[model samples]
Target: MSEGFNEASGSIIVRDLIQVIHEQRAYLSEIDGAIGDGDHGINMDKGFTLTARRMEGQLLGMSESLKLLGDILVEEIGGSMGPLYGTFFKKMARVSKGIGVVDGRVLEQMLESAYQGILTIGDARVGDKTMVDTLDPALQALKLANSAGRGFSDALDAMVEGAHAGWQSTKDMIARVGRASRLGERSRGTLDAGATSCYLIIKTLAQSMKELSK
Candidate 1:
């Protein structure tokens, strides 16, 4: 197999992301109900559905598709999630601007860029019961695996594990940001909506890249 996926695979990648979010919409909203507005899934579906429609019949490279998704999320979607995810996707697209094929190393860079991008706007940190709970550890694991000379598949698996662990960690955390923060101890028993969604996003990216690597 090649060391990377073709940059042209972006359309399919984004399409699968839409599918994943759509399928998990109800579950996401349910999780949010524990301490949040219970509309994270609804809003996410709205933005991803729009992105899917816009990508039809267009032959976009990975960066182009990612940029389009970021634009739609930033401009059309409302709430804190809009800007956070928009920055993440946009940063990934920016870092990948000139790449023809996206390799494991490039993917590591993209993930780091996305993580830092979120931190730029969101004040959330590890154990904050936010998406950073998922993203930060995931990036760390990916970086560690890559630095250890792990292959693409191994590094991707490591990231998946890290993200899952981070997502789970949110369940034990006191909500420290957003609406959930108001719930205090009530938020401890449930998974964070943002963290759950973020986990799905990371998992989807890893799965898609794994498939494309073949």
Candidate 2:
């Protein structure tokens, strides 16, 4: 198996992430509409697309690209998603500083840091049906995979699967935080938009790295 992707290839990889967000925008907003303000996809797509445009014609390392993405999300977008996801990516960039390649261990650290960063800014907990649901489970799964001596690809697979499961789990849960929480029992039976978007982000990251591994 390929060891991992070069950190320098982040420019292209980040664009891929933006594309994934763009494609999922409508779906995300639809889910949000069921419980919250219904603008999750639109807001996320706007930020990610704008960031991709700003990074065009530039060459940057993975960490630099991630920081740029985070900055754009925080500065350009409004609403909870902006600050939450912005901080998440920024923390990921922080932990990845000076890395030559993003291997299993490096990716694990990045995810863990990103998760903590979101937690620092947001009070969401496990089963709260927020992005934390997807993030925490994915991070834990990746950590477990790393501990089991899995290769980067295998570990990434574990992370994605865990994230998907976590996202799905939100459908059975009533929101305990955020705007959706106002709905109380009404929030049940629908997926949390934040968790859905978080899963997409993890899946996009894994797919982009897999492309670079080839």
Candidate 3:
């Protein structure tokens, strides 16, 4: 690969992204455990595990891999997160509509596009204390880093830091969305489960892309 994300990324290891999903799954679920129903890990793991296996079986090319992953997320997984995350990947696949390898710029566009998709569906904005909480900051950091001509790994590191801070900041935020909102004042001390998971997953992906860029 050259510098950043490559759409052909799926056409490459095909399994590395899946593996990152696997590694981050529990951490996300754990974060969810403190507030929500605590199934983020289980649901995400099931969805991505199937996605990984499905991609292995069906990915003959880049578009094919992206499409196949979308199908799995839409048709295979269960629960609220299935559609949400499934949509994220499906939207991400759009930026690489043609080729297989997605370079750093392509990956950045994909992430930015995916974030838009999530925002549209959920109607969550920054300070909503949802996944957007992590996404917006992380993406802005990436945009600034990319504009500065920073390398992929360096930009990714900045993203990780931003994501972590975003996740942590949620602890101080009131629940403006999701089931946690039911808690009212009681929800103040806990981090937004979705935001935290979003951070972990995005952070893991950035790190993975950094490696791919090398």
* Candidate 3 local Cα displacement, residue 104, angstroms: 3.4
- The C-alpha TM-scores of every prediction are 0.97, 0.97, 0.85
Which lDDT tens digits does candidate 1 get at residues 1-214? Answer: 5577887765677887889999999999999987998999999999999999999888888888889989999999979899999999999999988788887789889988988998989889888899999998899999898999888889899999999999999999999989999989888889999999999999998888888989
Per-model CA lDDT versus the true structure: 0.90, 0.89, 0.72
Q: Which candidate wins on lDDT?
A: 1
Q: Give the alpha carbon lDDT tens digit for every residue of 1-214 in model 3.
A: 3664445544443355567668877777777777788887787778768867666555354445655666677788856676667677788767778755555566678779888888777767888668888888888887888888887777788878878888888888877777776777777887786786677677667656666667
Clash pairs (backbone) in predicted model 1: none
lDDT per residue as tens, model 2, 79-174: 999999999889888988778888989998998888888888998999999999999889999999999998889989999999999989999998
**Sequence-dependent TM-score of model 3:** 0.85
lDDT score at residue 12, model 2, on the 0-100 scale: 72
Which sequence of candidate numbers ranks them by lDDT, best first? 1, 2, 3
The C-alpha RMSD in Å for every predicted model, in order, reads: 0.9, 0.9, 2.6
Residue 142 accuracy (lDDT) in model 2: 94
